[model samples]
Target: MFLTFFEPPADGWHVRRDDLLDRLSREWPDARLVPSAEMGKSEMRDVGWTYDSSEETVECWSAQSGDGISLDGDEGMVVQFVSWFRRLVPREIDVTFCDDMYSFSLMIPPGSSPGDVLRMYSETA
Candidate 1:
């Protein structure tokens, strides 16, 4: 449902998976990271989704569908979730998806909130 992109610092600083998970849990109590299956050594790794049952939302599919962060629920909930997610990323980051050319591949640049970016995407779609 959601994929986060960021240019690592010159010194190679990157987000720790545990730290990210803790932050997500703190900010959105309902959000859970569900792991995906890896069939063989050739299978893609580090795949999962952020699921929030209370809002019926999912983000970052494990299959690398590349939709960045996706929201599935009522418009209001989607809007809310996007906003919530935007708060966690630094300004240098670009939280986006690039799989669906027609409607889901926008590289939401910095400055605009994720909610605003998604709103624009929805309108254009």
Candidate 2:
């Protein structure tokens, strides 16, 4: 699965870059950051940093007004990432989750359990 964060039209996003980096470091200590030059040469668009581990990747991208995180890994790891992510960003940030067959968006409120989100997705998608 993939998850992205973006500001609503004409609104400010609540994601703090420093906090995000710190959390990522804590969560994936073994991941290595792919250099900016390498990122530029890759197929990704507007990606700030791409952190890679043996079995997974976390790509960070930025747009005019917001940041995005794309996570690719096993289902358990993805869910764990989402649980931490939901607690990292403040309430009301626009989040989009996508998979090969489904793409869905929601404003996941602060304190919304990851399990709840998963259940909701299963019901809807």
Candidate 3:
């Protein structure tokens, strides 16, 4: 799964993640999207939402936005989330996702035009 974060543009409105997900789903019914769920019963370090797959689950934890919990080894859900999220959020928001031992973060960087991030993952059932 992939996780993307968008710092509201100076002129853009600020919307909660939940609301964002809902709007995306409504606008794109074909997109497999949902608000990430907090990791339940798993003791990982990191505070962020989770996305899961039929075989594995992946977790995306952001130190800046996350509560500082670590989500290691939950690769499946994390990958799934990231992939679905990129397809949902506006195509102009920054995002991140974890894959294997590395994590990919998408950003517009400083002084760049508003942008978005996209991460993709694939797993067999």
- Please give the CA lDDT of all the candidate structures: 0.49, 0.57, 0.39
What's model 1's lDDT at 4? 36
Work out the TM-score per prediction: 0.55, 0.59, 0.37
Best lDDT among the predictions, by candidate number? 2
> Which residues of candidate 3, in runs, are more than 4 Å off?
1-3, 14-17, 20-54, 59-73, 98-125
Better of 1 and 3 by lDDT: 1
Our model 3 lands, by Cα RMSD against the true structure, at 8.7
Model 1: residue 122 alpha-carbon error in angstroms: 1.8
How many pairs of residues in model 3 come into backbone collision? 23
Per-residue accuracy of model 2 over 10-118 as CA lDDT, tens digit each: 5555556566667667876764565568656544434354455567555554332335566665545555556666676666564555553456665555675667667
How many residue pairs clash in each candidate at the backbone level? 12, 0, 23
- For model 1, what is the alpha-carbon lDDT of residue 33? 64
Which residue pairs in candidate 2 have backbone atoms (N, alpha carbon, C) closer than 3 angstroms, thus clashing? none
* lDDT by residue (tens digit), candidate 1, 1-115: 3333444556554445555557666876766566454322324334344555554555532223222344444454555555554555566666654333333555555565656
Candidate 3 lDDT tens digits, 1-125: 32344555556644444554474357434434323353443433223433444565544443333212233435443433344444544555554443334554443232222121222232221
Model 2, 103: alpha-carbon shift in Å?
3.6
State the weakest 10-residue window (summed lDDT) of model 1.
60-69
lDDT of 2: 0.57
